[model samples]
Target: MAAQYDAVIVGAGFGGMGAAIQLHRLGHRRLLILEREDDLGGTWHVNRYPGLAVDIPSATYSYSFEPNPHWSRLFAPGAELKQYAEHVAEKYGLRPHMRFGTVVTGAHWVEEESHWRVAIAGGDSVTATYLCTATGFLSQPKVPDIEGIEDFGGKVIHTTAWDDDYDLTGKRAAIIGTGATAVQLIPEVAKVAADLTVYQRTPIWVSPKPDYRIPPRLRRLFARIPLAQKVVRAVGSGLLELLMISGVVHYRRLRIANRIAERYCRAHLFRQVRDPELRRKLTPDYSFGCKRPTFSNTYFRAFTKPHVHLETSRIERVEEQAIVTADGRRTEIDVLLLATGFNLWDVNFPAIEIIGRDGKNLGKWWRENRFQAYEGVTVPGFPNLVSLNSPYSYSGLSYFTTIECQMQHIDRLFRAMRARNAKVFEVSQQANDRFLELMRDKVGDSVFALGQCATANSYYFNQHGEATLLRPTSTRNAQREAVRFPLSDYTYA
Candidate 1:
């Protein structure tokens, strides 16, 4: 007989941990968290490249229930995030339930048993009453399809799998992609590399990062008075909502807000880069918030350095020790760094093969029809399953907000299930369709629908040219709906 668990959660990241913690609180103790990585922290553990830190303010980045008042900076470094994850796991007793280096191949619903049979990589399987996939939005790394990249003789490294031991000091380095990750990394690499070339396919909108070290006195006050920290978190969240959430997600209603944000970013760029041509090259052709914007003080300044070269030409191919461009320009480098982002719609949509009722494949169904989930948690065909990183799931600027909102949804859902003595539950097709329509209508008013996003090449927009990732609503509204959503939406057994 396979090992049995009340709930089996794939991916032992913060999302899995949060799910486990919520389940434990609901009196469902038989849990197992499967992680492909050797340890926890998910992306925090996977990404260890220099200049890695949370783009959002640290105050708002963490779980609202458990806030860390000891962050060294307003925007804590990646190491601090790892430590925070460890602290959460230890405090919540999640370690024993987690199995590290465990690969989950797929899962299928067993109708007769009314349970999920989760398959492991080595032909072994586990039975769970409920299955939750929290594999994260950016779990799978995307390798660029540039010709002759495989034949490159020099050291090639992807940001996801950074080799910290291998020093880049005195070495010529070329970084491809200028997304949020590249924005943070380029400045650091420019400081050390003998010659640094930044390959830009699309210019990123970058604002001045108001990063500062938290004074010891302030930290002490926060540790002593938790409410003080809560106030700070509120302020931080409000700013993020006004700038990112409203300016971008609510672009139709808040066009002026978006323009103000765009002007601010442009002004920041102008202030940093003296050369008009360089500033123009750095400016994005697409509307602001078409792609995700990032905060970086040093990113613009890095290009002004003598050894740092910004290459705007399209990449033709990679030679043994040189990168050739479409403009017949060739640049030789000792190390090639791929800051290319993740494969979202293709590989990471479901993150794993999930077979639902009547031989319905979840991935296939979504691709064939549309990517959606009722309330961004439960689907119509899949019973007793919650996809944490589903379409229209991400509510606010902070991921913690999304997690907490989903937790609320799960808590309310499970409470209803327990009250009715139900063993199985699935979202109704009517509910799913209604929710999908609501999201479509809401997103129709956003920047993705109204603005110039053709040049953005953003992951937010899927293969269908629909921005299905973020929930086009405020954090408070998401939380309210999670708790107050009608129970009749789901059919319980």
Candidate 2:
């Protein structure tokens, strides 16, 4: 017989940990968390590249239920974030339920048994009445398929898998892709590298980050009066909510925000880059918020450095010791970096073969159906299975908001199941269809759909070019929907 548990969570990240804590508090003690890596913290555990920090304010990045008063800066570094994750886990006593170095290969719903049989990578199996996965939105790295990349003689590093032991002092480095990851690391790399070449496919609109160190006095005050930190979090969340409303939810009604963001971006660019040619090259052609907005203070300044060269030519191929452009320009470098981002908004990383009722593979079903989920958690055919960070479920502002909303949603479902003595529960196809229809109706007016995002090469859309990734609702609205939504939308057995 396989090991049994009341619930099996396929991650140890924020969402998974939050779910575990909520379930534990709800008297569901038979819980297990499986983490693929040798430790917790998910992305923070794996992404240890230089200058890695939270783009959002530290006050808002954390869980509202468990506020941290000891953040060192407005934007906490990756190390601090990892420690915070550990702190939360230890505080909730989640370590006892977590199995490190365990990778889930697949799961199948056993209708006759009314349970889920989860298969581990090493042939071990586990049985759970409920299965939840929180592998995260950008857990999978998107490596570019450039020609001759494998034949390169020098070192190649992806931001997701940074080898800290590899030294970069005085070495010629070439960085590819200018997304969020590149903006963060390029400045730090430019300082030490003898010469750096940044290959840019498309310029990103970057806003000035108001990052600063949190004073020890403020930390002490927060510790003394927890309400202080709560107030700060509320304020931060309010600001981001307004941003979301302008940029995502009510973009049509309030498009002045685009002008404001663009104005700031252009001013910042002009202030940093003295050369008109460089400034023009760095400006984005599309409307603001068409792509994900980035915040950086040092990325622009890095271009002004004598040792740093920005290459706008399209990459043709990679030579043994050089990167060749389409214009036949070859840049020599000792180190090559890929900042191509993750396979977010397209597919879940470390995808499991989820065999639902009637032998329907979840991956295949999504491919056929164009990736629709009932509130990004429950599916029609997959009974007793809940997936986190699913399509049309993601809120743009903060992951904490999403996690809290999802945890509350899951908690409500479990409570409903317990009240009715239900052994199995699944979303009705009607409910899934209704929710998807509502999302499609609402998304037509949102910025992602109307804001020229189709031309921006963004990850917000699926293969069909529909903006199905973001939830067209505010965080507060989502939270309320999670709690107040009727349980009759699902069928229980």
Candidate 3:
């Protein structure tokens, strides 16, 4: 017999935790949170590499309702984020509902019972009236498909599963991929490795990171007066929103702002690297905001070090202990580190198999038709299911903004369901289509549509060459619509 739950939230990260908290507030106490990993914190727990830190300011990276006043730095380290996740879980009593080390293979909607049948890795299963998949966008690790990689007789590690026991001191290391993860890691690897080689396929735009340790006095003040912390949070959120709005979302209208941002990034790189050739190799050819940009003060400087070398040639193959370039240059290394990003369009779009009404596969439907969700939460056929990491779901620069906005949407939705005394609620196809059309119109003027992004090789562009990952609106607008969306958009029974 399968255990029954009022709601089953997948992935015990902040998204899932937020969903659980909101559901509890809606009087859905019979809940379960299933996590594949051994613990919570999601990326923060999985990624423990050196120089791991949040790219956004700490003030805006947390939940708006529960702010942490004791962040050690402006951009807090990954460990502090994990600690904060633990703190939130404990404070909200979410730990009791979490089941770690539980892998969810798939889920299917049981129309007769008006519930979801969630299949676990083993033979066990659970039934829930409502299903919410909060599995993050970057949960799946992408192993590179390099030829002869298995023949390499050296230590290999991916950024997602970093081995802390192995020492990098004096080791010759070669890293593949120069994405945002590599931006944070390359500097730390250069400091210890006797020889470090960074292979770049696409150069990422990196602005100057204004990172600094917060003083104890400021921490005390925040703890004593919550309003002071709220003021700082508002300032941080405002700056990030301004960047997103002027530089990316409104690129067609604010081309000058985008160009200015690109020039600022170039200046940051020029200040660190004196060599013109190196500067050229580091600079991105595409327009700024085509892909997600990161903040780092030391990434460009790391290449200027004597021990670090940047390789621009494409990798031809991997030998036993050396990497062969397209130009026939072979570089020997003692360790291979892969900073390759996730497979978002392929395996990560749904994260797990989801079957809605009439045997409609969510992943297949998105790939066959289009990737979209109503207000980035519910699908027309998927009743009582909320996908936190759906298409056009990510709002603003900070992920917490998206999470909170979705939380508000869920709260409003459940309240309406309760008022109607409905056991089943699903988004109408008309509403989903209307929202999709609105998003398409909104993104039509953005950088991905108007600017040159063909050379970016960004994850933002999915398989269909559509940038459907981010919501093409301001965070305030997203939040406003989350609360003010027409209740008639959904069919309640």
Residues 56-129, model 3: lDDT tens digits: 99999999899999999999999999999999999999999999999999999988888999999988999999
* Candidate 3 off by > 4 Å: 1-3
CA lDDT scores, all candidates in order: 0.93, 0.86, 0.94
Model 2 ranges with Cα > 4 A deviation: 1-3, 345-350
TM-score per model over all chains: 0.99, 0.97, 0.99
- Model 1, which residues run further than 4 Å from truth? 1-3
Instruction: Look at candidate 2 and give me any clashing residue pairs.
Output: none
lDDT: worst 10-residue window of model 1: 1-10
TM-score of 3: 0.99
Candidate 1 lDDT tens digits, 176-199: 999999999999999899999999
- How many clashes does the backbone of model 1 have? 0
Reference-based lDDT, residue 150, model 1: 98
lDDT of 2 by residue, 1-493 (tens): 3338989999998989988998897888999999998999998888999999998899999898888899999999999999999999999999999999998999998877878899998889999988888888888888888999999999999999998899999999999999888999999999999999999988888988989999999999999999999998888888877764566666777777667777988999999999999998899887777677788999999999999999999899999999999999988999999989988644572266789898988888887887788887888899988888688777757888888888888888888988999868899999999999998888877787677665577777677788777788777788898898789998988
